[model samples]
Target: MKDFSTEITYKTSRSSGAGGQNVNKVETAVTAIWNVMESAMFTFDEKLRISEKLKNRINSEGLLQMTSSESRTQLANKKIVTEKMLELVEQALFIPKKRFKTKPSRGQVQKRLDNKKKLSDKKENRKFKF
Candidate 1:
């Protein structure tokens, strides 16, 4: 994974889900925010790639934010949120292999036609003739 720690800023809030009274007193929910435009880790092209791929996650301010509140401890939540952000960025930067389009061979086309004809024959036989 890339070292994005320098570009991230975290905010903590009280978690909303389970955990009894501990939930009320502790700020275990963490939100990690990173500005794609301001990041030094990625080049201009990489920044553009991330912006395009992760456009939904990034706000109008160009900040990519991820939140995690599953853990009870603030530190644990922070780690989870950071990991989530890293995963998102990594996915955004990934380039899939291009697909090569190819036509089916004569044997394949003939096999498919044969299968269709067999099905049609079976269906035709199932019909009740007067």
Candidate 2:
């Protein structure tokens, strides 16, 4: 992904899931925050793209935040959060190819009409005689 490592900041907190006694003792969960508005690594257009694409994840302060709690160690959780943030940014920056509109082929249209006619004939044959 685009190098935005300098723009990221990490915070650790106690993981909330299953870990028994370790959950209370260790701060394993990591939150990665990226300040999109203050990022020097992104251009105005790039920042706009990210902000628009990831609006749900961004807070009022323009910080994009992600969390990881799968790992037992803070360092592992930090790595996972950072990777996830990068993946999210890369996905936001991607522009999908435009769809080219096209009409159905003559053969396809004719096939559909034929099937409709067959169904109509079958239904008519099944009608009760007067």
Candidate 3:
């Protein structure tokens, strides 16, 4: 993976709620945009993987866009967005380890059979004798 830090672009808008007059005057909400298709951070295959995994978050323009208004400061909001982007990209790139099938051991199988036998006996005892 290449350095994605250089590729991110940020936009700001007025934050909503709880900041009183300060919210009206400042553009503190930060929106981070990174174009997956145009990114040099990954190969074509990796880009495709990212696009597929993040299809819902990505727009029609091929940009994976995220916003942060959690912090009152623009820099803090910007930091949050960058962290979100990093986490999302890492998740998209992750490959799950393949699973291998295994059979139960003899002791495990015997335990299951013994439990079933006990349950059967319990039910048999519950039925009225005829």
TM-score of candidate 3 on Cα atoms, chains taken together:
0.90
Assess each prediction's global lDDT (C-alpha) against the native.
Answer: 0.92, 0.92, 0.91
Per-candidate clashes come to: 0, 0, 0
Tens digits of per-residue lDDT, candidate 1, 90-117, equal: 9889999999999999999999999999
Per-model TM-score versus the true fold: 0.85, 0.88, 0.90
CA displacement after TM-score superposition, residue 18 of candidate 3 (Å): 2.1
RMSD in angstroms, all models? Answer: 2.3, 1.7, 1.7
lDDT (Cα, tens digit) per residue for candidate 3, span 1-130: 3459689999999999768899989999999999898987699999999999999999999989999999889999999899889988998999999999999999999999999999999999999988
Clash-forming residue pairs, model 1: none
